[model samples]
Target: MHQADMKLCLVLLILLFVTLPAQADNAWQAWREGKALLLMRHTLAPGSGDPAGFVLEDCSTQRNLNNEGQQQAKRWGKLLRQQHNGEITVYSSQWCRCLDTARLMDLTTPTPLPVLNSFFAGRGDGDKQTQALMQQFAIAQTAQPTVLVTHQVNFTALTGIFPRSGEAAILALPLTQPATVLARINTP
Candidate 1:
């Protein structure tokens, strides 16, 4: 091969290595700047749908997080702290699993926000719930980077993307425009 060709190849390789990390840093910067919101699905909870006669006030009646989920939540908290320098505010659904996942993250104490509650299980409240969340997000105060720990139903309603439990979508919020997804982050 020609020396010039080899030199060009080396330059391309260097750019490839540098460009990828720069892009990743930009994503994190947007998140840290509060220009983006992290919408996260609650961590693993075994079983589907609640059992018969489930009650909102009774956690025993609801499906709770499994052991793996607990660990996953904790890991997410650690990662966020490391990434953001310990500045994170988490809002979570009132459901047991959502609350548990948020708490396990070990960030600031999770606030139970009704808007983040799941409308799944044939509740038929999807539209109402989604509107409430949108309104709340629009007015939310941005003192710190925030994460909302909710369910798959809410994630789908907001972003039209069905996220797995424990996954997060980073979205950019503009006051006059609809939120746009900047990236999707998954726990490693």
Candidate 2:
């Protein structure tokens, strides 16, 4: 084989290795059946931590979803609409990125939850925020599935599963001290 062809094949292999499909250990089915919670990390916001002078109420002050992220969130909406026809309850962090992602999902109007906000970079107390989130979920249980759109830090604190941009983890109900992660799905 030619050197260029071999290089092309190597690149393809790397891409394949990195983009893993969500491992559904009944989690997908559970989510579709409205038995699990859907916790999502905000989609492809281009930058890292919030920029300086970050303000919770100000979109320009925070790191936010890019056009690609908007499109990705819409895809998630389409996927969710196809998967389950039952009612859904959506919650999102006050962050622009998270709120935008949840809104784009089109599942429902996302109610902002401060407990779901990112505690990364000393922005909030991770332990306290995580605990509050657990408590909130415990009290907010419903017959329909609940989706929480948040940041990587908040979700990781809850499930110990660091998420990719636009990733969703299927977590078992009654969110406990040690959350039961049923499955994970990256946006289609």
Candidate 3:
């Protein structure tokens, strides 16, 4: 091969080896540092919040997280424990899926916050509740890392972005303002 071609190939190979591991290490370090607040979409639910005839007050009528989703939630908790010593404050929507996901984590009993539920259910009261929730997160004083298990709509409303099922959007919460998205984790 030409000297120039050999040099270019070496550089490309170096970049491939160096950059990929660096990115992965960064992601791992981000988790270890607990600098990111995880906003997770409830695990493998087949449908959205509920059926048309679903009732907000009753989980039996809603489309909840299934057995596989429950197992996935537990797996996520195990991963967090292994990676970060399992220290996190978990918050969840009152909905069945979100609540179930939070509970399945087996980390802590999550605080049930109605504000984290999706506004897409035509729930008019969610706007005010969402504002209040945002304000609370904005002014939180705790140093422990936080996690929120919620629906896609609520996540989008807060972060202005949509996330898929079982996906986590990491946010950095500063002292006085709303949080900012740091990165996203889509765990298989």
List, residue by residue over 70-124, the lDDT tens digit for candidate 1.
Answer: 9989998987887798578899988899999999989888989988888887754
Answer with 1 or 3, whichever has the higher lDDT. Answer: 1
Ranking by lDDT: 2, 1, 3
Over 31-113, each residue of candidate 2 has an lDDT whose tens digit, in order, gives 66666799999999998889999999899999888889999999999988877777788999999999999999898999999
Off by over 4 Å in 1: 1-23, 139-141, 175-178
List per-candidate RMSD values in Å: 3.9, 6.3, 3.8
User: Is 2 or 3 the stronger prediction by lDDT?
Assistant: 2
* Residue ranges of candidate 3 with Cα displaced over 4 Å: 1-35, 125-129, 175-179
In order, the Cα lDDT scores of the candidates are 0.81, 0.85, 0.74
Separate clash counts for every candidate: 0, 0, 0
lDDT of 2: 0.85
Clashing pairs in 1: none
- Model 3: per-residue lDDT, tens digit, 21-129? 6765565565456555677888878875578777778988888877888888988888667756747789998888888998888888999887787777675465676
